[model samples]
Target: MSFTGTLDKCKACDKTVYFVDLLSVDGITYHKACFRCSHCKGTLAMSSYSSMDGVLYCKPHFEQLFKESGNFSKNFQTSKIFN
Candidate 1:
């Protein structure tokens, strides 16, 4: 019998992250399909995304949640936005 040693899991789904469909961001790995907006459950692209406190959000949701009246959040959470 053959064994595939230790598997890497997707943080969102808690499922195995196969090498072929891996999408890693900010040191975290996910399945290409698992890379989605946390708030709206919408699909996201590697080219554009917003990450806050390790959670991912689509552009609109991120703006709605973090942006307020032309003002930004008070550094409550470190964000890494790729757009």
Candidate 2:
């Protein structure tokens, strides 16, 4: 099959995304407007963000969630002391 098109579906909205309006992260493509922090619903167009299990989050929210889940360790200070 020969395919020659520059269209992809936005991972968030499942809508068509043209090449010019596409934003890619971690090999997933989203419409520029659809790329947002899943927690706060904030736009992530020009800021640092993280993705977990296919969901996007801003740095602050990412850290907050991890901290709340007890997955974020503050033991770095203790490790430093031991070293």
Candidate 3:
């Protein structure tokens, strides 16, 4: 998908940052370079991945992110958000 490439609010820096890249995996839209750590909510290292796509995470955040991203909760719970 094509991205407009703009400044987005960083969850860590809490300020507008220019997105330098994009991730296409999650299919969710956010500033390409603005993704936050799925655990501690910090920034993920760009060097951690060979390519930027979908949901990527820093080493420490991957496990939880993986579960959540995969909708592991679907097996045990329900939320109005999904309805």
Model 1 residue runs over 4 Å out of place are 1-6, 68-83
1-83, model 3: which lDDT tens digit per residue?
A: 88654554544335554545444333343455566654355655546531123334565445444455673221212343643
**In candidate 3, what residue range of length 10 has the lowest lDDT sum?**
71-80
Q: Which candidate, 1 or 2, has the higher TM-score? A: 2
Off by over 4 Å in 2: 1-5, 72-83
Tell me the lDDT of candidate 1. 0.78
Q: What would the per-residue lDDT of candidate 2 be over residues 1-83, giving only the tens digit for each residue?
A: 86455668899998888877888887898988899997788989546887777878888888887766667432212222343
With a 3 Å backbone cut-off (N, CA, C), the pairs that clash in candidate 1 are none
Q: Output the worst ten-in-a-row residue range by lDDT, candidate 2.
A: 74-83
Compared with the true structure, what per-residue lDDT tens digits does model 1 show for residues 15-42? 8887888888998989999899976789
User: Per-residue error at 56 for model 1, in Å?
Assistant: 0.4
TM-score leader: 2
Between the candidate structures 1 and 3, which one is better when assessed by TM-score? 1
Which rank order by lDDT, best down to worst? Answer: 1, 2, 3
Best by lDDT: 1
For model 3, what is the C-alpha lDDT against the true structure? 0.45
In model 3, how large is the Cα lDDT of residue 23?
Answer: 41
